[model samples]
Target: MNDIAKHPLAMDGKDPSNLRGDPIDPERYYSRSFMEKEWQQLWTRIWHIAGREQQLAEPGDFIVHDFMKESVIVVKQTDGSLKGFYNVCIHRSQRLVWQDNSQKSFACPYHGWVWGLDGVLEDCPDRGDFPQGDPVGKLKLSKVRVQTWGGMVWYTMDDEGPDLLTYLAPTAELYKNHQFERTVRVNWLRVALNTNWKFWSDNFNESYHTRTVHPQVPPIIDQDHFTSRYEMFPMGHNRIIQMGRPSLRDRLPDGVPHPFDDALRAWDIDPDSYPDFETKAMQGWLDLKAAKKKLWKEKGFLHYEHLDDEELTESPFQVLFPNVAIAPGADSFLVWRWEPHPTDPEKCYFDQWTMAYPIEGQAEFVNRTAVNPLRLVEAELDFREYDNGAGVQEYSDQVVFQDWQLTAGQTAGWRSRGYRDPYFAAQETRVRRFHEVLNDYIAGNPPGR
Candidate 1:
């Protein structure tokens, strides 16, 4: 009910007619040939998220994102701009850095050929010995295109593809109220899952599985398809604007303490005053919005000032084409990046970054999907193996943990001879759209070309 005006470029995401009725091909999930094709056609042509812009706050600070078999170094330059290059030394093609850190110049650990933060060769041990006389001051590391949006530093391997904003299209203009650059990431995590990377792409595109998988979420986030607005953009991006209120039908049992009540009381609305559960959910949701609009100034929620009624209390989860998912909510901005494993087609990596806007006096943030409340401070990256859910035991309470647990089953299912095309729900239309757009990319005619 609170959805804002839809952007002109948005397609009806709930309509399956927009898709080409592509089968959710099983071979694409397990075949090496399919994986190589993705690398050549899809992964090479699209933009990728390296890290948050805040990570490179000062000049010389750099972050290295290694995707599949390629690694790229993104550096904050002395001119206050960002630059990216293949993480390879010009001399002998040696890898320069393995991790992120600040450095005035990159010294090739293999042979000590020094290159400046600007990627220009500054020195070499045997300058006179080189037959290519005086390579220093002239030779430069190969550059990758770099850009920033919604607090993320993104780079594309393709030199000729669309710009970041153009690729992001109406999505950039849709959430202009959100000053995502102001948010602070409290959790930075990377986990290796033994499932095709597209599992996440298909999983996040619809909420049809939420009721069965995440039973606790229905009462709080409204899991019903009718109440949500699903939108797919022309550039293959998509969004689902779920009402922030509870599902009126998916009620908790009587005598069970409801989670929705807690939100009502926090917003100073008396949840007990409502005569019935439906009124409390339906009416209290509206009341909660009004209370927030009135109390936000004094309540330290300065981020709410420019947000619309929908943005103030709604959930809009976005999938940025091939791999990135971002939830730019009123209170938090969550990002999930799914990448294929280096060698294993059945393995993939998922990055979950929980970011929260800092309120004036609020020191700790309670993100709904995080395992626990986190202090409003930047957290260093924690990389771990899924190890069949053993390595990620600390994140057991996280909702993504449930999805991680299904990796083994899903991985085996993809390889089964009995595996056939999926019977998709209408709400899962974007899932089909994702694969069709991917098919277009492989055919050398990507959407919005």
Candidate 2:
């Protein structure tokens, strides 16, 4: 691995200078050709997290992923095995599935062609007259490599990319600490953006903007006494660890649960409507030290709290390159999925799966030991209105809007004569590392520093 400390932009004790210039023109990220090349060279050749294994909680349960330019379905067979295949009908190349729930077989909406959960041709209209000698024996949905980790289901466009663990090797140890298989509630969105996918990937890689750009989201928690750390994986994967906010139980009146404590916090309160107090006075401020001390003792945070200053300054912020972010915390975990736009490199879909796992003995979970992942069959959002006058998921929407406004704006500027090479932040080492690894990938050179 190239020593992170010696990289051209890595600076010790001071912010790196190489990264302090104008942000890269978002235009390059919006270019159609640039996106097309990235899709072929990077996305298609790597393992991408498809969905959660729990989604296929039972036999026949399945979810379809519109990956890159291809449609895929990951299904759980009756034998308790997992399988994936192109979501297209073998007959006329039409899509075979639309809904993400379970079915005995997938029947194409265009025609009545049906496929078994195992991707076998279970039924074909007028098959008795065909000379193809029973399409059942000759037709099977084209399959892809499917695997599980931390309870997340992943698939690759390539039949030959490294297995899930191998691709995640650089940060496997840290990821194992996540215990994803034990997680509870998970809700995801399929977001489409009008820019390159990397724009979203790099945005989540750092926290320097939390206090400014995302004041509402960051202010609810303690920002001090934490770390901001990152690890880059070959093949454009990156992980970010942002420190967690201190407990806010004391901020609430006695017997009232902290609003943010609920896994369904977003369902009740929109984060955008909340007040933005500085971290110091945000919650239980007068007695933060005492509150944290008592909360730590009761919650056992003191035990999991790392002694290393770096770990202390940061919480776990991990990004699976190309498109996926697993950001877990003691209170809740956020899983984001970035899907590509079918025709617009300047646009792609984005989804957020906000999950909260019950502590070992929380009464809400009657079967704490049994793997009973909560299912969210409905969302409370008014999608027709971006924020509906609030911004949590919409905050994410706003961020994407900000990105889109700029990327689209920059596309106009890419043609301007005054546009120049971009600069990055010293703290924004993740961005530099991104391009470094990206350049290597583009040149067919080895990944990792």
Candidate 3:
């Protein structure tokens, strides 16, 4: 593994000294009171991804991000800037926008109050009938703090919360090389799962279950803990940088076609040239990095120019505090965001977005997890329920589907009397650290203010 100490802002996430060793209580996952506390303290205070900035390209284009019982609207202004507001009419608290679309102005269905693109009250009926002053040009929609980062529009309900960049900190700085804004969202899917939102937070913070749950991942993106670098930032985000090559310990049966071999051959390297599996896994990985660095520009991989050798060949899976997990690669970016259900602590919505940079000749992008060949375009929203694996039957082969299948069982396990505090491995320190951070938020003290 590379020397993580050489990188700025990189802390040993696997080190127990970085954490408080807080017991991950079971109630945090399934209790109604704890869910309410999280809704008030954590979810509302943290920066939330409303939608991709690409969704709001033109003026007056907006996307409504409904979280729990609250809805927020992120819209593009006439001045070529983005603004966010609570998706409620100022007069009667009626929801102004029901879905994402472009419009000249927001009109309340209940009261006929028209709000302009700038969020000001443009017009209202019966101007002289109100006891107060004229509603037009005086009343404005309530605003939320909005910011853009990594091609996504983010808004926070808390006025005193940290700024987006400050909250993101080294994470935003680490990904400054990749032009995430230029990538197209090839897949936008939401799956309703019967599990707490914390299930995703815990699942993503550790890769210990990858070998058992996502067996296909080890062969493609080395899941060996010793080979990966674990980094936890003070800003409540954690990242695991895994080698993009196959794990030396995980070898497919002899004569089986290897995905790593195909990856090497795609970059003009011969996988068979290596004498053994270990050599092929290790040396082939180095060769792939060299191949990418040497031929990136000629092969139309323009996004790789600013990336370092490690960034070009490694998979950095980042878990932004609480809900968002992003796996950014040289060519493709996979993002997963989990949100709590409106009324059920045992149910949550999960979003998976596959984004890829447009190559000169490549017309489609195949995501590693889903393996779905998607066209290079902004896809429409797709919502599904994990109805015993029937609703999204096509996604049954996905890594997330495997995880979804375990959610119900895990949720039941959490509520079991036999359940006890998690006995975490050193590599799984981030899982406990995530809970400690949640404790911080619940105790009215979150990191970065």
TM-score against native, each model:
0.98, 0.70, 0.98
**lDDT of model 1 at residue 225?**
91
Cα RMSD for candidates in order: 1.2, 8.6, 1.2
lDDT string, candidate 3, 1-449, tens digits: 66645347767988989887888889888899999999888888999999888888899899999999999999999899998999999798999988999999999999899999889999989999989788899888999999999998999999998899999887777888899988988888998988999999999999999999998889999988988999888877999999999987899999999999989998999888999889999899989989999999899999998998888888899999989999989898889999999999999999999999999998888876664888888888899887988988988888988888889899999998998899989999999888888899999999986
Candidate 3, poorest ten consecutive residues by summed lDDT: 1-10
* Candidate 3 total steric clashes: 0
Ten residues in sequence with the least summed lDDT for candidate 2: 1-10
lDDT by residue for model 2 (1-449), tens: 11223222223311334232334555556667867767667777777776777778799899887766787899999999999998888788998776578888888887787888888888877778778577865689888899887678888877766777777655555544445565655344443444556666667766555556533344344433233344555445555443344323224443544434332232232333435423323332323334443454465443323323223223566666656776655445567767667777656666766665554434342111112343433222222222322333434334434444444444455557687654555556666666655555555552432
TM-score comparison, 1 vs 2, better candidate: 1
Each model's lDDT comes to 0.90, 0.57, 0.89
Give the per-residue lDDT digits (tens) of candidate 1, residues 1-449: 44467778888899999888977779999999999999999999999999989989899999999999999999999999999999999779999999999999999988889999999999988788877688899899999999999999999999999999998888789989988998988998999888999999988888898898888788888878988988999899989999888898798889999998999998899889999999988898899899999998899898888998888878888898899898998899999999999898999999999999999888899976786889999988889999988998988877899888877888899889998999988999999999998999988899767
Off by over 4 Å in 1: 1-3
Q: Quote the positional error of residue 372 for candidate 2 in Å.
A: 24
Candidate 3 has an lDDT of 0.89
